[model samples]
Target chain A: MRPLIRMAWATSRRLLLLMSPLLAFYLALMVVHQVTKRGTDIPAIAFTCMFMLIIVSTFQGLTFDVEGFMASLPVTRAQLVRTKYLLSFLGLLAGLALTLAVAGLAHALAPGRAAAPTPEELRSAVALALVDAFGLFAFLPFVHAFEPSRGILAFSLAAILALAASLAGWGLDGAADLFRFFQRVLAQPAPALGLIGGLLAFGLLSLSLSTWAYARRSF
Target chain B: MANLLELRNLSKSHGAFNLRDVDLAVPAGTITGLIGANGAGKSTLLKLVLGLLPLDGGEIRLFGEDARLGGARLRQRIGFVQESPTLFPLLRVDELGEVVAPFYPRWDRATYRRICDAFELPRKTAFARLSQGSRMKAALALALSHEAELLLLDEPTSGLDPLMRRDLLDLLLEVIQDEGRAVLFSTHITSDLERVADHVAILKAGRLVLAGAKDDLLESWALVRGGEELLEGPLKDRCRGGERTELGLTLLCEGAGSLASLLPDGALQERPSLEDLVYFHDRGKESLCAR
Candidate 1:
C-alpha cells in the first residue's frame, strides 16, 4: 500500500472501531423512524453532520497523544498532516454517503409515500452537506494544529454555541429576510461561485496557518 | 570513523531544568547505555536526537546526517522506543507491523515475524489491552522491524519485570550483533547496562559526570575504606562520595593507580562495581556529606 493510503487505512480502521456502536445506534434510529409515522430526511442528515463533527474532532485531535509514536515513524510531518486531512475528507464523504443512502431508502420505503428528492432538493442537500462538512473541516485543523488540548474543545464548544444561536435566530422576524436572501443567492450561480471562492480562501488560509504551526512546532 | 550518532554542544532548557552544552557520541557497532538519575536530562537529550523536541542551542548528527535539519530520509534509518508504549489503541498486534511497514523502504517483515515469535506476542491482541511488558515488546518489535541502523530507546525497560527485562535486553544484544547496528539506550537499570553496554555515559543533575568504557570506569574508580584521620590526611581529595563506617570511611575515588601514592598504608582500595560508580557519581553532594 502507498504510505499515505496505509496511514489512511490505519486511521479509517480506528474510526470504524470507535464508531461501530454509534453506527449501530444510527441504524436503529433510522429503522425506528422509518417504521413509525415520523417520515423525515432531516433527522438522518442532522445525525450524520453531528457525528461527522464529533468523530472528526476527536480522531484528528488524537495526534496530540500519539505525537511520540508518529515521530518514531520514518514518515515526515507533512505526510502525517496530509494523511490526517485525507482521512477526514474520507470521513466527511462517508458521512455524506450515509445521509444520502439512509434518506433515500427511508423516502422510498415510507408507508404512504413514493416521493423522491427533486433535482433542486438533491442539489440543495449536496450543497448543504458540502458547506457544513467543508466549513467544519477547514476550521478543525486550526483547532488541532494551532490551539492544542483545551483549545480545540473551547473552539468547538464556541462553534456549537454559535450554531445554537443561529438556530434561535431562525425564530426572529429578520430570519425570514435572511432566508429570502439565501434563496436569492441560491437562485443564481453567483452564490455557488461565491461559496466556492470563500471556501477556497478559508481552506487555504487555515491550512497554511496549520502547516506553519506544525513546521515550527516541537513534536 | 564517523560515529553512528553524535550530538555537538546540544543544549535545551526547560524552565528549571537545563541541559547545558551536552556533547554525546555513539559509535557504530556498539550499545551505549545512558545512565542518569530521575529529573536528569536523559529524556530531553533523547528527544533532541529523535527530533521530537527541537534543540535550543546545538547540533545533532545521526548516521553522519544532521539531525536538526534532517528530512524523512534520515528518519528512515533511525528507530525509537519511548518509555511508555504508545501504540494505536485499536490496532491488533499483527496489524501494527503491517501498518508501520509502508513508511520504511527497508522494512523487514521476516525479521519482524521472528521478533514476534521470540517475544511470544499474540497477533490478535489490541495494544491497549496488552500488559506493560507486552506493550513494550510490541513497540520494540515495530522499531526493530524497520531495519534501522540506529535505535534510540528511552527507558524501554522501566516497567518490566526482571525476566521481561532480561528478554528485552537479550533481544537488543542480538539485534546489535550485526556490528553495523548501534543503540543509545537510556535506562536506570545499571545491571542491564553492565550486561550489554560497551560504553556507559553517566548523567547527573543534567550534566555528564563520567563517560567512557564500562571496564575503564569500573577500573578507574575504586572504593576505599579507612579511618577519619586516613580520610583527612592524604585521601581527602581522592575520596569520592561513599558509605560511612564508625571505625572507618568507605569512599569511591580514582583507582589505586591514580591515588595509591596519596593514600596511607592502612587504607584499602577496592574496585567499584558499575552500580557503585553510578551511586557515587549520582549522589554528588549527599555521598560526599556522608563522611
Candidate 2:
C-alpha cells in the first residue's frame, strides 16, 4: 500500500496486460519445444526470451506520456525512476523463473516425451541471463530519455557493437561462443565477483544517468 | 487578506519564451482569474506552481512554506485540473480514481462518488469517449474530491458551451463556499471570469500587464464613445486605445470623469468590462505606436 510499491504494482499490472499474450504464446511454444524435443538448445531460447521480455517491458513501461499525471501525484521523480527499474528487473527475474518453472512442470507432466533438463544447461542459461542483463546497462538511459523507436534503435546499435567486440575476445562462433567464454569466466570465483562488481557499478551509473535525464524533462 | 499562495520573483525559460519576474498572491475565499491570449504562459505559470515544471529562478510559497522545489507535500494541499486533464487515458472515470486516491491521504471516495453523480459523469465510459464538458466535469469532480485547500485550474472553461460554461462557473462558486478553498483559474474567456472572478490578472506575452481586484480595476477605468471627429485628435492622445466602429468612435482611457466635459453631444461613457480591458490593452499597444 506504500506509494512507491503501489505505483510499481499499477505499472506492472498494465504491462502484464500487454505482455500476457506475447508471454503465453512464447511459453506455449517453449512447452511444445520441450515436449517435441526440438532443434534449438533450450537454454539459448530461454536467454533470448528473457532479453526480449526485459527490453520489451522496458519500452512498454515508459511509452506512455504519464509524467504529468504521475508527477502531479505525491511521488518524486526518483521514486518514479525507481518504480521503472524495479518493474524491469522484476520482469526479467519473473520471466526467467516462470520459464524454468513452467518448463519443469511440462517435462514432469510428459516425462515420456523429453528428458529432464541438465543442471549444466540451467547454469549456462543463468549465465546467459546475466550477460543479457549486463547488456541492459548500455541503453537504460536511452530507454528513459528517448521514445520507443529511437530507444530501440540505440539498443540495437549497442547490441551490434557489443557482439562485434565479443567476437575478438572469444571465437568467431558468435553468441554461442560468447556464452561459453562467459560460462568459463563465471566458474572462476575472483573473476565472477569482479564481473558482478562491475555490473553493480555500471548499474549505479545507469541509474544516475536515468534519473538525471528524467528529471530534466518537463511534463 | 491572508494569502494562501504567493509567487515571488518567479521566472522560467523555455527556449524561445520566458516568464519573467511575476509576483502574484491568491488569498483564501477568492477566485483569481488568469486571462491571456494563446501561448501567453498561463499554463506554464500554473505548472510551475504545481511543480509540473521546475522554476528556473524564484520562490513559490504555499501556505507559507517554501515550494520552490515543488514536492508531494506541497502538491498534496493543492488540487490541479489542467486544460484537458492529463490523467491516464485508458482508465475509466472510476478506475483512475483508485490510482489517484492512494496518493492523497485526505481523499474522500464518497465525496468523489457524490460529485460524479452530481455531474452525471458516466463511470463506465472510457474517459476519452466522454464529451469535452463531461470530461472537464469529471476532472473537476476528481480535483474537488481530494479536499485540497487551493485549486489551480488552467483554462477549465475554454471549450465548453455557453450552458456548460455557466454550469461550470456556478459549480465553481458553490465549491468556494468553504472559505479555506481558493481557486486560480486561467482562461481567455473573459465572460466566464466576469461571472466568478474576484481578482483578475491579465497576461500579455508571459508578463502580467494588470493584476488586482476585478471591481476596483473596472471602477478606476472608463470606456468613452463619440463621433470620430471629436475623438480622433488629442483625445485619442489621452485614450489608451481607440477603434472607429460603425457606431463612429470608441476609446478606452483612465480618468473618464475629467474627460466628460471635453466630449461633444451623443458621446457615451461607461465602465470597461474584462473583455474591454483585454481588447483595449491588446489594441492599445499597436494603435498607440501607429499614432
Candidate 3:
C-alpha cells in the first residue's frame, strides 16, 4: 500500500475499534425502531447513517493535535487534505455497510415483524445510501478545513440550514407552484444535467476554499 | 559565517506582554541556549521560528530563506520540541511512528528503533499514560530520529530527572559533534548550558538583552569585592548588583581589560562563569548603564 494509504488505514483502525460499540448501538436502535414502527424501508436507516458519518468524521478525524506537532515534516498541504478526504469517505462506506448488515439481519430473523417492503422501497434504499454517502463525503472536508473546534459548529449550522431549505423547497410545490414547474424541469435529462452541474460547481468551490484555508493555517 | 537561522526585528505579543524587535541568530553547527525567566518570550521566539504563531512584525529566515513563506521542503530541514506541546493521546508508541514516518522523506526506521530501544519505550503503551519524564524522552526520540539540520528545543530538559537530563544533553552534544547541524535550545538550567552551549542568548521582558559566544560572555566579566570606596566612586558604574553585606560589597564588572585598574586595592578579580554572566545580565539591567 502507498504510505498515505497505509497511514490512513493505521489511523482508522484504532478509531474504528473505538467506534465499534457506538456503531452497534446505532444499529440496535435502528432495528428496534423498524420492529416497533412496522416500517421495513432501509432508506431511513441509511439516511441516519449519513448524519452519523459526518458527526463521527468531524470529531474523530481531527481530535489529535498532530498538525502542530508534525508540521515540520516534508508532507505537503495537498497530501494532508487528500488523506483526510479519503479517510472521511472510507468512514462513510464503513458506516453504510455496518447499517445494512445489522438491519438486514434483524429483519431476516424477525419474520412477519414488518410488512414486506416493495421493490421501489428497496431501490430507494440503495439510492439514498449512495446519495447520502457521497453528499456527506463531499461535505466532510470543508467542515474540517475550518479547524476541528470551529468546524463542528460551522458544519452543524450549514447542515441545519441545508435541511431547512430542502424542507421549504419540498413545501414550495403546493404553495408556490413555480417550484413545481422547476421540479418538472429538473426531472428532464437536460435540466437534470444542469442540476448536477450546479452541484459539481459547488463541490469545486468548497474544495478551493478548503485548500486555501489548509494552506494558510499555521501548524 | 552566515547564521543557520536568523530573526530580524521579529516581534509577537500575547495580551499585555510584547516580544519586541527580538533579533537573534545561531551560527551553523553551534548550540545556542536561550535563557529567560517566566513569560520572557522564550517559547514565543520558538513558536515564531516554527511559524506556529503569526509574527507581529519583522522577518525570520531559516538557512537564509524566509521561514514564514517556506514550503514543505524547507520545513523538512527543521525539528522542534515544544515546552508543553499537546501530544496525540490516542496513539500508541508504534502508532505514532506510523503517523509521523510518512511525513519525512528520509525517515530512518533503524534510527527510530534505536531511539525507542534506548529510551525503553514500550511499543504498545499509549502516549498519554507514559510518565512525564518518559514523555519527554519519547518526544526527544521522535525529534532526533528525523535527522533534521536544525533542532529547535523549547525547555526540553525542564522536567527531567538528573540522569535523564544528562543523557539528553549528551545525546544532543553527540549530534552536534557531527558538524553541519545546529541546536537552538531553551532552558532555565544555566548549568546545563554552561556544560555544552557554544553560545548563549539572554532574553528579558521580550527583548534580547545580551547574546554572544559563551566564552566571550564568560571571559568579558570580572567578579570583584571591596569596601565602601568600591561602592562610592567611579567604580559604582562597574557594579552589576550583588547583595550588600556588612563585610563588603560583591560585584560583577565588564571584563578585566581597563575595568580592573580602577578596583580598590585588595579587591579580588575572577572570571565569571556562563551562568553568573547570564544571571547578572538578565536580572541586573538596572545596574548596567549603557556607556
Output the number of the DockQ-best candidate. Answer: 2
Off by over 4 Å in 2: A38-41, A44-57, A146-181, B128-133, B227-238, B256-266, B288-291
Candidate 1: give the clashing pairs. Answer: none
Could you give me the TM-score of model 1 versus the true structure? Answer: 0.88
Looking at model 3, the pairs that clash are: B220-B255
Q: What global local distance difference test value does model 2 have?
A: 0.76
DockQ of each: 0.55, 0.56, 0.44
Each prediction's TM-score versus the true structure: 0.88, 0.89, 0.81
Residue B21 in model 2: shift from native, Å?
A: 2.2
Error of 1 at B6 (Å): 0.3
Please give the range of 10 consecutive residues that has the lowest summed lDDT in model 2 chain A. Answer: A38-47
Candidate 1 on A40-145: residue-level lDDT in tens? 5643464465466447533643653676677556666666665555565666666666766666776767745524545555555555555555555555565446
Considering DockQ, where higher is better, how would the candidates rank from best to worst?
2, 1, 3
Weakest lDDT window of 10 consecutive positions for candidate 1 chain B: B282-291
lDDT of each: 0.73, 0.76, 0.72
Interface Cα root-mean-square deviation for all models: 1.9, 2.0, 2.5
Runs off by more than 4 Å, candidate 3: A1-8, A28-39, A76-86, A93-147, A150-196, A211-219, B226-231, B238-250, B285-291
lDDT: the better of candidates 1 and 3 = 1
Where is model 1 more than 4 Å wrong at Cα? A31-40, A43-50, A53-64, A110-114, A134-139, A146-148, A157-187, B243-247, B285-291
Q: Indicate the worst ten consecutive residues by lDDT in candidate 3 chain B.
A: B282-291
Q: Name the DockQ score for candidate 1.
A: 0.55
Candidate 2 interface RMSD (Å): 2.0
As a whole number from 0 to 100, the lDDT of residue A7 in candidate 2 is: 52
